[model samples]
Target: MTEPVPAASAPSGGCPAHADVLPLYGPRFLRNPSELYREMRQEHGPVVPVLLEGDVPAWFVIGYREVHHVLSHPEVFARDCRRWNQWDDIPPDWPLRPFVGYQPSTLFAEGDEHRRRAGAISNGLFAVDQFDLRLRSERIADDLIDAFAGRGEAELMAEYAHPLPLLALAGIFGMPEEETPGLLRDMMTTVNGDEGALDAYQGICATMERLVAHRREQPGPDFVTRMLNDPANLTEEELIADLVLVMTAAQQPMAYWIGNTIRLMLTDDRFSLNLAGGRRSVGHALNEVLWEDTPTQNYLGRWAARPVLLGGQQIDAGDLLVLGLAAANGDPRVRPASDTPALGNQAMMSFSYGEHRCTYPAPELAEVICQAAVEVLLDRLPDLLLAVDPEDLEWSPSVWMRGLVGLPVGFTPV
Candidate 1:
């Protein structure tokens, strides 16, 4: 491991004037974040200042060791957004409100509350039979491919990667087929922070409430029922909040992982040749993408609970910090100088770490779903090829997630 980088000193009374507060949104950063990260690391070390959607100042931890330290010491760094010092200053119409704003779920909880909520989520998800989940995912993949297999060319992001995870999650939650489409639309709208986001969010809440009521009346073998029966005894509001977390987490990251992995397999010549020539498996491709281009590039926002020195930087109480997962994964200290694959290496912080580390079955399920989706598509469309030049591809503008805007491809029509 590389020695952790020391933080630069700030003035006695406030944040250092020289701190580089990079804009996380907008076209420039979205286009080539890796380049910007490289520059930031070289010039500013790991803990750089950054502006969120509303020009909100926060620390962006980019070094692998530094991020690991920050995540490990949750005692000093807290998850509760109520600890944020400038929370009152942020306006209501911030574009990233839906994501960075406060929620009642475990994502924003700490200590005992985190444990309780996380336990409920784990119990709920654990009740899901992995085998059944795989089958469901495979079936969804086949059905989705069938829709575009005849077209000979299609945009995979919207037509396939984007919907498969949502459909699978709906199945796991036992949502009715009639209601799944509307639910997905509402969730998407909320995530994009577009027009009617508030209305769409309300729609989601209403739909979830209906689902909970129906499950209570007619219990079934599903995630909601499992949570309802868990010893955690989550309140009705807590149940709804946790369910929303699970659905959002499952859908967005899985979609991005599938899309990013597929993009790598289709565009990177070495990856494509290795997989085709039997030197690499879909798992290898997936792992490489996780390391180099993780779907959730930034996450795990923490507020400094009290005055502390982290990686030599002085952080006052209520200071906000976000882990740069993608940047940390590529941190030179932990990664090799060469581009060779590090087989069996699972040290990446994409899923994060410490007390809030993502419980198993969720991450495993995502991997299985993504791998299954890719295999089914490749098997069905053997000659799948990028419809546009790789350079022309674009990524969505997001501070927390990194995903392609679209993935257009051409293949032989079946």
Candidate 2:
């Protein structure tokens, strides 16, 4: 990683003189931020400063030009939040940062340790020569869609959304169906991380321990089995860590966004009409969903390795940094090149930018789910519509991840 850009010097005045701005403080700015962001962008132009960081003082970066510059410059910016994300490292005064319990999945890990595990998993999980793995995912998607199609007016979240990816995950890891219930509990624990949640993380660690031992003893064709069969590829610990990150990261947002895609279409007539056409148009619809409706809301939470000056702003060392992805994606300046008023474009930071981008990009993940989820549902029940109004749905109170608490949709009997 590059050394941080030197912090700009200033006189007795609180902030640097290069820019005229006040530190932003508002609940709406932190919580339901879209409205506040729009106002800030309009008034502040390309520089909108705000307070953030779970346990440290920092600036929330919320401008098109500034955010792009900061994200592109990773040396100064590192995704090393060991100070806040880890259990013991958290300061005694503050509550544990939500979702810190299960994050830092080798995805959030940095340096050689990160590269070794991420590379190992990337190779093992996505070795293109393994055509059988791709076929397995497709088959799993098909079976899942078929099951949901049979039920008219299914609650997409409970019936189809959450279950499909969990099934796919089971196939990839070679875990038994009987064990998935315990696994899901562990997965949800990651979402509501606490001391108890951290304890559940240990339960996950134990599950992985048992599974790895089993894989070592009885190697098979599944991902873990394949890696264990040829131990030369990665160290045993690296393999275990990657498995944990891959399984947990893969399941959480995949299921939520798959369900949310259908939710967006149900909420808006334009999105619905776009999906009514041929399969190729699915890409456009998916892009629209990613830009307009995000599952994992912000770029990964990051901490400064040292004091740095970025995008013409000075950030002190150890300060927190939040890249407000949803705001950037909606910023009118970087909107997609479409004749119609585009809801969003893929360049949007929804999947994030920089070294810590989501392992599964939104467009690709959505394409797979849409092809599998939509094909079955659309054919079986052509008139499916949302049971709840878009405005009425409750989203995660979470400022970091903009996901629906529940998305209720209904379909006529086939």
Residue-level lDDT of model 2, residues 1-414, one tens digit each, is: 322212222222222233333333323423455666666666655544443334223455666666777667656666656643233434543323433323545655676766655555555555323345445556765665566566665667666666677776677677777777787777766653434666665677677778888778877767788666543466666667667766766676776667666676666666677555555444455567566666665544566677776655666665456677777766777753423544334466766776556553323543564456655555556678878767787665555555666767676654
For 356-383, candidate 1 gives per-residue lDDT tens digits of 8776668988887888888877777778
* Candidate 2, superposed: residue stretches over 4 Å from native: 1-32, 40-56, 83-105, 128-151, 192-196, 229-233, 274-277, 336-345, 359-366
* Residue pairs with clashing backbones, model 1: none
Per-model TM-score, in order, reads 0.92, 0.78
- The true-versus-predicted C-alpha distance at residue 256 of model 1, in Å, is 1.0
Model 2 TM: 0.78
Off by over 4 Å in 1: 1-20, 195-198, 274-280
